[model samples]
Target: MNITAIKDKYERPILSLRITVTNRCNENCLYCHHDGMITSEDEMNADEIYRICKIAKNIGVQKIRLSGGEPLLRKDIVEIVNKIASLNFKDISITSNGTLLEKYAKDLKDAGLNRVNISLDTLNPETYKKITTKNLANSAKRGVLKAIEVGLYPVKINMVLMKGINENEVKDMFEFCKKNRIILQLIELMNSENCDDEKFSKEYHYNLDSISEKLLNICDDVKTRDFMQNRKKYFIDGGEIEIVKPIDNSDFCANCTRLRITPDGKIKPCLLRNDNLVELISYIRKNESDEKLKEIFIKGINKREPYTI
Candidate 1:
């Protein structure tokens, strides 16, 4: 197995990588950096994404995550997934908004997709509309059902808690996830990108303490796990909820293991600090060598600066 030493001090080995296949999306979630839409004219082609995935696999990256503004929007998404699975990766999963996922859930699972992370911020129809600025809850619900039926184990539900937005829907969302036997994660809104900055304020900021207290009311026992440095997972009423502080806060992120790949093949080492990205495929095609490709993957991992020295 190949391994690379990241820039951080001696710690755990880097093993997971998140690849964003497309900048395009079908919905406009109020909390995302790009309004859940494509801002760039250029996006990564299917082959280009696979190229990166292949290189990562050779270098002992056991887990691969497919993300995007919404990955399911790509017409050739299934092919991309098949190609990644062909690499024999230990895990292959996708993070989608669940609107377009309904149509492909079964196909994806059959094509080697191990699981899915569906971003459902609210369960209330009106709240859903307010958050996504669209009428698409039905599509999301259907996607969840289809994903489970297709055997997307640990079918995780990513719920973002927004103040004055949909905080009231937390319990209902938990019930929906629990009834469906899915993992429900509650995320604190992080004003990371430009669009998020535009809406950044105390009002938009929902504190974790208040959220934690309320979770205890319903959960038989409130428990948290410091999986990584700043990450803490809350288990309420036998439902899994994760609390993520804004990524921008330096102290909150220490176990910076997974790398983020934008839709256009830009490699982001850290989600909060939008810097130090290496273009792997375009450069690979120009020079084209396994050694060169592997080098890029190592460089991306080594650039970790969780606790910069």
Candidate 2:
């Protein structure tokens, strides 16, 4: 079936879907955005998720990523992975806190998960506890190693750089990724609609411009991912670092090709705004026809616009 890909009014094609499987998390990170979800209750089941993905697949979406407050919090995560894998997405990955990766990494890989992105903001146990209010830094480190051992290739570490918090640990984090042959993604702290704590954002939002400039000078090679908001990937000696500075970045919003699904099963058009969500679970629960669901998908896509622009 030659399905034509759908594009928003801005002419950006919807190529990837980021589904928040569960809003429940084990860590209380000081900078957590809760996956841009306003509410966390009443998460969709594996079957509903599969139906949503199927509709997405039929609409020419090729990639799928499972995310959450911490995706591993869900007990049926492996089952969810299996169902999504059955749709034959070009890629099946998850963004997790990594505390439970050691226990679920192999099972996830076996269930057709292609890769993983684990959040490890700091290597210092004390600092980790300070940021996350959890004493699981060592456990997360073990999970990182286990993910690599399980052949989850290109296991990426998502390090959200905060001004007075873990910003100074970027070099150390890069070294750690180099030692393990993993990719490091340095994400600038962002303020979302629900997490718009003015004082918190002002205190912790670190500008990534200087770090990006430093990487540009020392990087052996550089690559730009056009589909991913034109983010740059810097290749160092044996390590890889990707700089994600979405705050006030027009190009980032212009080139985005992602559609987010909230944990409660609403089609979230933009990560920064929640007002334009198109409900899906209610229709799915009503056993709506595929045509009806596709209309809902198109309605959501039509709502998509560059949040920064």
Candidate 3:
């Protein structure tokens, strides 16, 4: 099969596919956006997910990211990873809250997972419980270590900066990531209607400008990733940090190359909007041809647009 890269009308080539394996999560964080997906129990099985990924690979999407309310919650996660890995994607990763990494990281790695991104907002147990409404900080921390030990290279930690909360813990979190040789991603609290709470964003959205300026002065080097919303990665004293400022950023939207699949199996064109989803699983359930699935994929790609712009 000749891989032909698909592009939207905005000329952004689709290079990455993000699939939400399930909406069920163990933690209820204050800033959980649920990946802009409605709660659904009808998640696609491993075989169905494999079919979607196979079609995606045929269309030249080199990267596949498994996400969830918590992707590790799925019992068949290892099987899912094994199936996707067989497609031979350039990258296969997952975004998890990290409480289950200690138990599953080794199996996932052995199944061909390239890396992982774990969410750890604060190292302080009290604050972690306050934010996530769960006292599993120790479990999450251990998961991080286990992932590193299992040889998941470049294990990234996602810390969403929140004002009057964990914002002051930046230096502490960076130190931990540095000690673990992990990449730290400082994410700005997203201001979206799809979030768990609208007032939560208004109350906690910490401006990253001040933080970015500080890192700019001390950084040893800087590199821009064009495919990933042109976000800047900073290297400081043998430690690495990446700033993810997705709120109200035109450049972030302009350079996005990701196509999302909701837990219930719809192609989501934009992360911040729920109106333009193209139904996909219905045809797949109907046992449609691969060419028919390809047409549905193209239809969803045509609907792609920058939410911020």
lDDT of 2 by residue, 84-141 (tens): 9998888999998899999999999999999999999999999999989999999999
Q: lDDT per residue, candidate 3, 207-286, as tens digits?
A: 89899999999999999988888889999989999999974788888888999999999999889889999999999999
Error of 1 at 288 (Å): 1.4
Over all chains combined, what TM-score does candidate 1 have? 0.89
Best by lDDT: 3
The lDDT for every candidate, in the order shown, is 0.75, 0.91, 0.93
Candidate 3: count of backbone clashes, pairs at least 3 residues apart or interchain: 0
Q: What TM-score, over all chains together, does every model reach?
A: 0.89, 0.97, 0.98
Sort all candidates by lDDT, best to worst.
3, 2, 1
Between candidates 1 and 3, the lDDT winner: 3
- Model 2 CA RMSD to the hidden true structure, in angstroms: 1.2
Give the clashing pairs for model 3: none
Residue 239 accuracy (lDDT) in model 3: 97
Q: Could you give the C-alpha RMSD of every candidate to the true structure, in order shown?
A: 2.9, 1.2, 1.2
Which should have the higher lDDT, number 2 or number 3?
3
Error of 2 at 120 (Å): 0.9
